[model samples]
Target chain A: MAMDEAGGAPGAAKKFLYVNRKAPYGTIYALESLEVVLIGAAFEQDVQLAFLDDGVYQIVKNQSTDAIGAKNFSPTYKALGDYEVTKLYVEAEALEERGLTADDLMEITFEDEDDDWAEKPSINIVSRADMAKIMSEQDVILSF
Target chain B: MATLHTVNKSPFERSSFISALNHTVPGDKVLMIEDGVISARKGNTFADLVSSALSDCSVYVLAPDLAARGIAEGDLVEGVQTIDYGGFVDLVAECDRTQSWL
Candidate 1:
């Protein structure tokens, strides 16, 4: 595989890791961070998203923004596949700490174009140590 | 290469400001935005830390964030430069990487 240089020619896709540590709502970080990810998809970069700490709550099922008067954007995660962003790493420790399980998260998937449009799960449950290693290997780390 | 350190929380509300300051190296640039702009104001408790950091690194405050909070240019601490959103983009481009202290 050819490696892409930073801000270089086309096809030069740099690895972009977006770290989310904040929960959705109460603050604009989570929503704004998603906006950046969506916009960055245009660059065709190798994108990876990590959800840890309070950020794990973002993918929880049945989030109702009706009472809070906020637009429910949790569904956006399901749309990430269309943008070619399918890597969503959820920290196992974070989920356990919050008393959540993989089953509690929303079903987010992407169509594998190369695999004959097969539907694939986007979420990858990983240990904290594994996530840390992944973070160390990224070309760029954008945290929120 | 210098890192662009961004802090979005207020020092009065969180210790993110102090943590960001402690982690920053001599050549790094600290850009205060959102509620973090509160720490850039003059005569505040964190004024000393901001002033001290200025001697070794560049300190900046987002103009729009300051204006949004009614913090005038004159209210900024000494040696702290104020930059607009365009400047923020430029800073990100100029630095090796960005570290946001949430």
Candidate 2:
């Protein structure tokens, strides 16, 4: 309901890539970026997310924040598809070195409206080289 | 005395670790503290980067910090020396100056 502000007149849509490089819960960077991504999606922009290094940990399942007394917002990521902000690029190298695997991440998907509403995965595991190329193609890059 | 280069940020979070490594001299020492110790893990993507710096700089990690993060000594990269607070103090005294990377 609050996202209505971003739905003002849609201008020429530009490619916006938000790069998340911080670990979840270490600071406010991870959650802040997600918030911006959700709010930004309302503008009819070509939005995407890139999770690398510690950023990959943001989507890890079974995240518990009770000890830290912080509100667990991990569940909020599942709502991104409702905002039409899919395309989450996860660096394969980041997971390998962190002793994590694709199986460890939360399942996030979106429905393809054009293809008779087929469900498609938003989490795309990509190589570092491919990540580099994708980043270069973005019209604007937002770092968090 | 050689310089003591300290990195307090996680390598994965920023370029601080790599920047510190790039600025080191052949005999300089690099110490990881706080979240910077994350890069010292043997299996992480940055392990090779740390290993490459070993030929030119002596790499160290704070044992307490690593323990706090639940990273075992055995899981660290080869040649990465683990030290206590006293060792950290000694490094500061042994070096000409201490430089920190945010």
Residue by residue across B21-78, what tens digits does model 1's lDDT show? 7656667899999999999999999999999999889999999999999999999999
Pick the TM-score winner: 1
All predictions: root-mean-square deviation over Cα? 6.5, 12.7
Model 2 C-alpha lDDT versus the unseen true structure: 0.84
TM-score of each: 0.62, 0.58
Instruction: Summarize candidate 1's per-residue lDDT along A21-89 as a digit string, tens digits.
Output: 788998998999899999999989899998977889989999999998999999999999999999999
Q: Model 1 lDDT vs. the true structure?
A: 0.88
- Distance (Å) between predicted and true CA of B99, model 2? 25
Candidate that scores best on lDDT: 1
What tens-digit string does per-residue lDDT give for candidate 2 at A70-138? 989999989998999889999998899899999999999999898898999999999876775566455
Using alpha carbons, what is the TM-score of model 2? Answer: 0.58
Q: What is the TM-score of chain A in candidate 2?
A: 0.91
In angstroms, how far off is A124's CA in candidate 2?
0.2
Q: Candidate 2: list runs displaced more than 4 Å.
A: A1-10, B1-102
